[model samples]
Structure formats: structure tokens, C-alpha cells
Target chain A: MTAKKIHPGAPGLLFLALFLLLSLPISLRAGEALVSGQYLSAVGQDIKMQITVAGPAPGTLIVIQNLPIGTVIDTASPAFNQYDAGKGEVKWLLTHVSPGRYIVNLRLLSPLAPGGISGEIRYKNPANGRLINLPVRP
Target chain B: MDSEKPLAGGIPMVNIDGARIRRIREEKGLTQLYVATVVGVTTDTISRWENRRYPNIKKENALKLAEALEIQLADIIDHGPPTTPPTEAPSLLSGEPSKQEAPEPQPAGQEQAIPLEATAPPTAIRANHRLASRPVVLFGAFLLLTLSCLALFWWSTANDGENQVAAVRTLPAHATPGITFPVVIEVTTTSSRSFSLILKETLPPDCIPAQGKPQFVSQASDPPILKWIGKITGEHTVYCYLAKLRPEAKMDTVHQFTGGVTVRSDDNPSIPVSGTDSLQVSPFHWADSNSDGRIDDEELLSVYETYGGIEGLHFGKKLIEEIWASKGYRFNPETRSYEILQ
Candidate 1:
């Protein structure tokens, strides 16, 4: 009768397999940040621009609207902090931004140019003061 | 004698151990024919039942066999071999304890603990039957545990294994007295299990937090401390505050920020804030992230995304734009701010 050969490392192999199973990564993603802008409509020469932000309100969040140099600025709902007409930059310094939609309304002087409105959102992640800049979407 | 595993609502059947049946039949000097005839089965079926080849049989058939053997249904029900001798009067199935509840006198053939052993191939099991004997399996398991612990220790030591949080500290190019710079630690959780973690940050001795709590887990420590307890939910959370340099902090001098994060749990995994052993105090604008004299197109665009709408910074976004439009810039020590070289 032939005898079975016992491999010495069998027990060790069994345990290594068990440990590998425990260390596999778990996948999940349930958080988000979005900055967007829309041209609602236009009156005789007054165009409307709406900016919205959906995120945390823990830190100061900055948004800027770069309009055409010749465009006239009527007013802003959540009033802008600065307006440099030479550069056509309408800036809003929104502080203590709470969770949910934060909107900034702008009444531009004329019908929007094809590429007239271009802007972005700058946020200082409070946890790690690292700055994240996201473009304001169309 | 019913197995704990759920059944499909088919006819009731049970696993017969057969060892007790054989012993009872032999003791009574009863031939297989007599027992088969009494139970109204062929001799072959009774033989199969005696050898456990037909381990599971109809519950009614089992009851008939018990009556023929002058025993109870539990007597021949398979509970995986005997641990104790049969009782004087065989009890009914109601008296039968579960396989787990019954005293187990296991032989050397199978392992009850390590589930991994069950996955071994038949040939491998035969091979490990000798090599993976109880003592060897126990030692291997212990060694595996020790090695796993050592590997985790080495990984955390090597890179701070930012496996829990990819956190970064926001430091201004330099610290200015009477002016508080931001101490921002942004942590993004990679795991979703709910638990609390305490972040302990050791600031440079030359600085103190503008305002916050539990600077120390205990007493206020020598180097001003920053302690934050966070109940982590799956979210993009940020921890930020302001800190100013001490009066003694000299111009052009740099101080490092360091700290550790401890997760409260059974394993108590503690991850040092990655790269905190030392850090460079880069002198640059929150806008000129790269510390270059110019906020080039890309950097300015990034600034717009990260800090464009952030409030409370004395520095203006227009200045960053001017810097972007300029040839370059320089830090005027007297002003403690960067200037565009128009």
C-alpha cells in the first residue's frame, strides 16, 4: 500500500488565505460638491445670471463672475464684495456658508455674449486649509 | 435529532448514526433478516441503515426501526459519533441535545475550529492531516497573527499609512506676528464605519491657536496643542482655525506643524498625520500655491476653484489675477505680502 505524503506548509497556506480575505478594501462614496451657473433669461438689455453652490457651510467660500468688459452691471442679489469693471470681475465673498444651495444673482447690463460669463468657486477645506478651485459649470 | 439546518418542508427524515443500531442488533443476537422483516423493509435497506450508507431515512421508518429494536428514535440518529455510552432506556427525540450541546469527544481526523481547513482539497487534507495536526495549526495561526501585526506596524511607521484620511495641513509661506495664519487640517475618510477619532496636533512652539478646545487630551502641553474629537460619518469634513506666531517668532524663520490621529476602537489604530515628522514652512500666498512669483494660468484657475469663494482672507482674488497678469512677483519683507512686479 502506498502512503500519502504530508506537505509541511499546508497549515501556513491555509492561514495566509484567511488573512488576505480580511484585508480587501471596501468601496463607498457618499459625499459631493458642485458649483454651477445658469443664464435664466434676459430683459431688454438686462441679462440674468444665477450661481449656485451645494456643499458644507463650515468655512468661507469665494465665487467670481467674469463678464465682458463692456457689459454694464446693474446689481447683485447676494451683493458682490468687489467689482473691477476694467477686468469685468464681479466677486462674491460668501461667508459661513451653510449646508445646501447658496445662490448669487446678477443682473448684467446687456444680452449675454456667447462666452460672456466664465467663473469658478474657491473653497478652503476647513479640515486641511487646502484650497480647492472648481469651475462654475454652464 | 433534527439538524439545526432548515429543511425544504419535504417528508421528515433524520441522519442515523448506525453504530448504536449495530451494537443493539448484535447484543440481541438478531439477524438482519429478522430486523428487516419486523421493520417491513428488505434486508439490503436494513444493511444500508446499519452501515450508515443510507444515513438519512424517513422519520416514520426510523420510528418503526426503533420499535423493532425496542429503542427510541434519538438512539440511532446521527449526532456525529458517540461521546457517551447509550442510556439504560433509550430516550425519545425530545431528549436529544443538538450536536453542539452534546459532549464532543472528537477523534484526530477533523478540526472543528479553523474554517480555512475546510477549504483544503481532499488530497491536501490527507496531507495536512499529519502536518496540520492541532499543535501545528495552533502555532501557525499564532505566528500568522504576530506577522500580520508586525506588517501593520511597519506600514504605519513607513508612511503614516494615510489609509484612514488623506489629510493635509495648510500653512502660509510664513507666520506674521499680530496676524493669525490659518491652521487647516482637511481629513477625508476612506472608510465608512461609524467611530470617533481624536486629532492631536503639535504646533510649533512659536505659535498659539487663536481659539479652540482640548489643546491637550490632559493638561495644556508645552508646545500649544490642537485637539479635536470627530464622530466620523461618511462625509467630506474640514477642521480649520487660525493661529498666530508668538512674539518671539523671528522674521524669515520657519517652524514645523506635526500631529497624530487616534481611532477609538478595539484595535485602537493610531495613524500619525502623514509627513508630519517635519514640514516646510513655505512662504507664499494662499493664492500663489506653488510659491512662484507668478500665479500662472493653471494656479490661478486652481485658486479660483479652491479659494475663489472662500471668505475671511485679507488677501483679495483681484490681486491674484493681477499677479497672473503680471510678469512675476516678489515678497517685500517690510510689507509681509507679495507684490506684482508691474
Candidate 2:
């Protein structure tokens, strides 16, 4: 078959669209992307935790973390999350997050086991208008 | 015969005729010295009576002389002397210095007034006057009254603090052994003031405290000597303690415990108030819910439930190890009972 030269414009548009889709979450969540956690006591033995979030509106965060088996998350500042003691999973509903950093304090009791306390913070990215996940370990 | 009559003073007496005294003595052939020795008088006095130098002799002496002479008392005495006026004889009213010898003339106007000695008698008169004066009697009475008032004041003040009261109270004046009892001590102030307070209860030697040791109101334990120290005010202060009677308490005897409190006020340091109270302990069996004097698993569970589980479990498992276990108590699973081991 005889080759016909076609302009590469359509491919560029496709690449741009893919780029926009990939970068959508970052743009929508523009103001800031920050989350941090720290143990309120000197040793990690203490069950008190303080979590801070900065910028944009990270509305309704779902935090999934493993706690010592026997521990029950008894109390939290800004109020409590839906927590499952057996699964060591906790979910928080955060709204109207300010542009700067703010803290949420948490307390648990009777920590029976010791292991990595890892969690993914899921929030609605304001830039892409879609839910996004950020990983954290404190 | 007249010598036998009573004298003018109505004393039973015999009048001795002085004139017959010498005649009788000479007739007896008794020497005056011998008569004087028997009569317990000087020989000079005997001679004066026999010679009539003394017109009258005492009736007692007359009787003694007559007895010595072996004659009647009337033989030695003058019968006329007892009836004679004493003023006409040797009268002291005559104002003569030697009035013992005979009467003398006195000034005419001295009938009502007494004759005053120039110097010697004034001292006696002044002393007599001072004793009867109204001023001296009044002064003595006033001094006695003042001393009485001062003593009354001292007595009231000395006992004022004692009358102010602090008190102690114990719940269930009598308690059963192996059970805990509440003890309270109260203090009331004499005056409105801030003060330091201390409450103490001395447990009987056989008893143990549920809390391990007595916790003082503010201070440390003196043990067997339980005590407390703190500050207080005008209101009454109360202190509390929980103690357990020994499980092995004897049924026949009662254990005595004493409690006391002392209060020292800042304003009134000199006066401190203290009070004391007592409690008694008798035999009791634990884990015996039905009062059967024995323990079964059902009874143990019943007791645990009654004691409010862990919070009220003063004599729990730890206490079993320390106190009750050695007394032959063991848990039997098959029987489901806590029994006294054979």
C-alpha cells in the first residue's frame, strides 16, 4: 500500500490529554499537600498521637493504620473516627481544613502488640475534584 | 463541927482554925520541918502559918498539914477568914504596891475608873484595845474576801480550755473480724481560729489495716500508733480510716481499739484540745454468706459480689496469700468449694 504522510497533531492532543489526566489530582489539590504525625510522649510506648494536616481542603480522610492488637482507640481531638479494634483500622471525616497546619490529637489504651503503624490517608483532592491517597507512618 | 460546912464558893471544904494549928502540931510532937515535908510546902510557909504571920492558909494546904499532923483539918485553919470580906483583908484595890500584906487608902474619886499603873500597864491596855477595834476586824474580813475572789478567777481561767471540746466517733462500735470498719475522728474548736489538727487510732496488736498501713491526715505513720496532722479552722474537723479485724479473733474476747485527736491553734498556742474514743472487735467468719461458719465456692462468689468486686476487695486473693490461705483454706474444683484442708 502507498504511504500517506499524516500530521502528528492528533497524537500530541492525545498525549496532552493523558498528561492532564495524570496531573489532575496534583493541580486540584494545589494549595498544599502535607500531613505529619508524632508521638506525644518520649517513648513510643505511650498511646498518645498528634496528627497535623496543612493546606487545601483534605475533606474526609480515611486513615488505615495497624495498632497493637489489644488497643482500642478510646478518644480523639476534633472527635473520634470509626475504628475497628480487631482490624486496627480507623477512618476520619475531616472538612474545612485551613491553609496552614492544624493538629488532631488521639489517645489509645492497652497496646498489646508492637509492629509498624502504617496508614494511607485518603482525601478528596480539591484540584482534580477526586479522591486521592497519601501514605504515612508515624 | 463548923469546919465540915461548905465554903462561900460552895466548894466542899473544912475551915481550919489558925490558932489551933500550932497547938495541934506541938501536941503531936511532930516537928514543923516534918509537917512541911509531908504537906509539899516550904518550912518557912509552915512557920508563918503556925506563928500566925499569915492570917489564912489555903484550904488544900490546911488539909494536907492536918493529915501530916494526924488531926482534923479544922484544927489548922481559921474559921472566920472564909466569911470575911476580901476587900477588908489584903485588897488589890487599895492602890498599894504591897497590897498582898494589908489594905491601904485610895483617892476618893476612883470608884468607877480603874487605877492605871504609871507605865507598865499601858502596854497591856493598848494591846487589848487594838484587839477589839472594829477597823482591825473589817480589814481582816476584806483581806479574806480579796483572796477568795483571786482564787476563783484563777480556777476559772485554768480550766477554760479544758471545757472546750474535741470529739472522736467510730462507726459500728463493734465490728466482726476479717471485715473492714470505718473510723472517724472529729474536732471542735473552743474559739474561732485556724489551727493544726492530728487524729490517731491505735489498733489492737492482733488487727491489720486494709490499706496496709494507716494513712495520716497529712503526716506519716507512727504505726501501732496511727496518727494524722493538718491545719483546721473554726469548724469541726473529721478524719476517716478503714481497718480490718483479724480473721482469727477469739469468740470469747473482744479486741479494743483506741482513737484520739489533738488540735493546736495558732492564736491560742497555750491551749490545745484533745479527745479519745474506742471500738471493739469480735469473732467473724468470712466467705460464709449463710452464716454457717464455713466457706464454699458459692459462698465465696456471694462474698465477692457483695464486696463490689475488685474495688471493694480489700481481703482478696493477695490477702488470702498473706492472711487466710495458711489457715488451711484451699479451692477445690471438683467440689467447687473453698474448704478447710484436712
Query: Could you say which candidate leads in TM-score?
Result: 1
lDDT of 1 by residue, B240-266 (tens): 556766655666576777866665432
Off by over 4 Å in 2: A1-138, B1-162, B211-214, B217-223, B265-280, B283-342
Chain A accuracy as TM-score for every candidate: 0.63, 0.56
Residue-level lDDT of model 2, residues B1-342, one tens digit each, is 544454476545545554577787676555565566456577666765554544444556666777677777645556554542321133343342322456777888888775554445777777866876668789888988998999999677545544365664534445466566555555665745464444556667766664522255222233455655555666666555667665566543555656654443212222222333434543333333344434433333233332322233244444322222223454343453345543
Best by DockQ: 1
- Model 2 lDDT tens row, A86-127: 666655544344455444445665433344465556555545
- Which TM-score value belongs to model 2? 0.25
Instruction: Please give the TM-score for the first chain of candidate 2.
Output: 0.56
| Per-residue lDDT value at B24 in model 2 | 75
